[model samples]
Target: MCRSSQTRRACGRNDVVSTWDSLRLFSPAQYSSLPGRLMPSRPGELYPNAAHVVDYLADYEKRYDLPVQRGQRVDSVDRDGPVLRVGTDSGPWTARAVISATGTWTRPFLPAVPGRRDYRGRQLHTVQYRRPSEFAGQRVVVVGGGNSGAQIAADLAHARIDLIWVTQRPPRYLADDIDGRALFDAATARRRALDEGRTDAGGVASLGDIVAVPPVRAARDAGLLASRPMFARLNTTGVEWADGTRAEADTVIWCTGFRPALAHFAALRLRGTRGHIATVGTRAVDEPRLHLLGYGDWTGPASATLIGVGRPAREAARDIADFIRH
Candidate 1:
């Protein structure tokens, strides 16, 4: 199976229902819509859990009668004459164009810090984190400054563990009233401004970094979400700050984020220096037949989120249809 499919299947399982504890949608359920269908309403849930999302997608698939082949692993995608050849474990299929929606979930990124290999403790990325109880009785250091880092730190704070959340810089919290809805609106405004050749008003980044979700808010209010500066290096016992401050930790969780999973497109050789395919909107600049979706802002503003991907997806479909017609 593809990496994204594997992620979805794993998430659907009871043991690992979501990527992490307190993992809820950043946006309201109303904004989580596909091209034609709206997400089924969940009463009183402005932010629903990951399992809710899994159920919604499963139901969407069945209700739409989508012909989705389960467990088919795609190995490569390359040009074959005038069409694109998709090599999968089951067989090869040719297509006039291809939409690569395999998201970055499989490609968890862990930054290389000095002495990382020498540290004698467990280290994992956010993708590997499930619940806080697993790290009970241990001194844990959570890294990164993004939402995942904040959420994971908050999840671990109330548990029976010694938690130290550290970021590269001071953590920035969005206003209490700001949520994914506001972030999405900002993104939309930014996109519109750029399209009209107006001065850029900035997107979600201008607001702040971490959204104060229920757990995060509670943690912050209780003074459990205080973050420290990033450590300089890892030693046998723990991490050391540049100022010689050291903290012993049994585990380090890196919430550094992810990269696009584009290994399947290696055969196309479309990746540029930044390790991303240059695109005009969703269509690859080098390979017009190739369209990427749900990667991130490069594909379209806020394209990586549940609520943000629909517009870009619709545009990509329209582009694909236009390509096929000509």
Candidate 2:
């Protein structure tokens, strides 16, 4: 969990479940409480919506009577005297230390395509997607292949509009290495094979058989939704594919995924692998006081799954708590 020679060796086993108290869990979801009734049905479903999270936090405060300020957006955090000074949108407060949990979702990753700002269609990120009804009767193109991408693509499949799923890479089995270019090509081939209702020549699995995520795989089974490669460019009127094909859509949901908001944390000398903060397990570069939870350490072996992240979180919290206790 704390990323040393010993911890790395121990992590080689898949069944290890570390104690929870050792980690500092900075769940950005805690910033907003949730209502009790909202639940996510699928693994990647956006459950415990922000409202639910906020409601839960309020209950937690009532139980433990913790002091939590709502509607306060934190501006800066710095060590000052015996406590850390956190400057928020409202005012400043102090803490013996801080756990920065502003999640990656707050920072949606958008591509810097040339004519993006000029597109007239309702271009929105998944973060803003409240419900599917907003997209009823609209042709929708969803981009990306990660959990969010897959879920959104599946959600918008039944709206009676032209639904095109585009991604630079394809989805692979949980254990696959997730190599980008190779995955994209593989996914593209799978889409075409599934559309034509034939087994892929290369033995790749078809998305058409999938039964979950709005059960749009039935469409693929029924030959409705056609998975395709990404568009080459975006114009106000429509999208231009690499093959020079054009399709107009009423809305484009960029479920492309998110990147860590390291810009706000630039002062920290973070070591990075793949443009993301690199970690030795959960520990940040050389800063033991800082740690990362959801970073993809390796694509598969030591992935950053929710289950994987828990171990590091517990370890970090324990280490930080001990230091503070002393």
Candidate 3:
């Protein structure tokens, strides 16, 4: 339906550039277009814009003839005897097995701070950030220490905006040596260890660590990537520090991350703490008829990511197909 050049990814943070931080499975060819893959640069500057991934996905849909009905916002997923009925905004569809790939994009998490409502400055979540030019010449405060916060803060600083990067603690920047490939190798190793019944695989490098993309790299090169400790609360004009210090801002961008969008599965009674459904290799522990595709590490290591999603998706597909056969 969206033949327009401006789709969701184009409008959503289109100005923000990103590097593929890991090897996303399913579409290996699409992954080929990722930064440093085809578009190589020093320290991963040759990355694709967010538009590349969006377009690739669209093309993949057409190429595979995937029966994906866009614009059908699922309202609920309930069980009807042996089949599952997915209630949507448009209508209801019944399936033998349901694979919920409902990613975290719709649910942006903002930390609760006292007087958060009192701040008069423009407020937005990472979901709403498009470009830095809008905040040019304005004092901006970016919250959270993860990749989005780092990249966005870098964008604002590059625009010469009065920028304040605030994290709960200091942000961690990934080393220059660690590219997306290396992260994938680590994830693969972790997966292998898990399969071998080894619990001592130790900690693989966290994908949540910030990749040094061009903007972020430039920000670091210019000494602009520094983040202050999070402020205690929001006030009328700005944020107040825990130590009684305060800073004024024209806008606040919350990159605090997201929780899973699993409310649709509420009717199935499969939710766990923090909106997570416990899964054993993508199969819902309580409901084997359901498979969660890309809700993050609980489903599989790096499975929530672009490259990492492929492995779990492939596995879940096989399991679902086999289950349906039996």
Candidate 4:
């Protein structure tokens, strides 16, 4: 954490800056080694970096002259080569073999709160949060338990703005604590172990370790961030806690993680527990011609990350080739 004693919000409005096109891209190397089973191994920068991978995919298509479609969001699948689809603006589109890489953000898990849809305090998900300067000098509340919430709180702490880091569960690591690297290293080790057959014992131990550390204390000590319980309701002024406590904020950031964006194929019987798509070793759904990139492991660390995506993509491609040959 950058410790400039002068409180960040103390900077006048003129000092605060906002960058709209704050998007970023990741290098192939980082993507190849992303640690979380379903996360894109993004290079940490001030801006979001997945756009780089999208660009790289486009470039790969051009280099190989592969017929890759860009900006075509698939709407539905059918025998006529997969039906209609759309653009980022929800325009129409279609395809035969469909692959969903949208990951968690597109369809976030909005909890069942009575008046949540009515509260208007600039509610936005971390996915929508490109940078912190937008909320400079304003009271902000962040809700989530994972890395996203931790990182955003840290960023805001640097800005000298009042921030409340809330989660249904409590915080674990310190705000200044950079302990995710340890988990990443452990996941990497587990991957190697599975490859070497050390714990091929049905991937029982391959699960990410469940470690919990006290939240508010570390965050408070590292930075002056506050923590609280699950949200019960929200109004124009602030959020109401389950215990009847209320926290005021100008903005509420839902960092409560993501859900797979596969509602287009909800009718298909391809999902496993919790509506997640089940795959037989990364090969496309039931039709092996198409393949799943970043899903939870059917077995192994296959579902946790972009690093997981690479192996599945390769394996699926090979399987397609074999199918073509036979």
Candidate order (lDDT): 1, 3, 4, 2
Q: What are the runs in model 2 whose C-alpha is more than 4 Å off?
A: 1-67, 81-83, 169-220, 267-275, 278-281, 294-309
Q: Whole-model Cα lDDT per candidate?
A: 0.84, 0.51, 0.71, 0.53
Tens digit per residue, CA lDDT, model 2, 241-312:
878899987788887767754443444445375456655445555455555554443221122333233444
TM-score of each prediction: 0.94, 0.62, 0.84, 0.65
Which candidate's TM-score is highest? 1
- Show model 1 residue runs off by greater than 4 Å: 1-18
Residue 226's lDDT within candidate 3 is: 82
- Clash tally for model 1: 0
List the candidate numbers ranked by TM-score, top first.
Answer: 1, 3, 4, 2
Residue-wise C-alpha lDDT for candidate 4, range 17-41, written one tens digit per residue: 2211232311133433432322234
Report lDDT (Cα) of residue 182, candidate 2.
36
Better of 2 and 4 by TM-score: 4
How many residue pairs clash per model? Answer: 0, 20, 4, 23
Model 3 CA lDDT for position 45: 24
Model 3: residue 276 alpha-carbon error in angstroms: 0.9
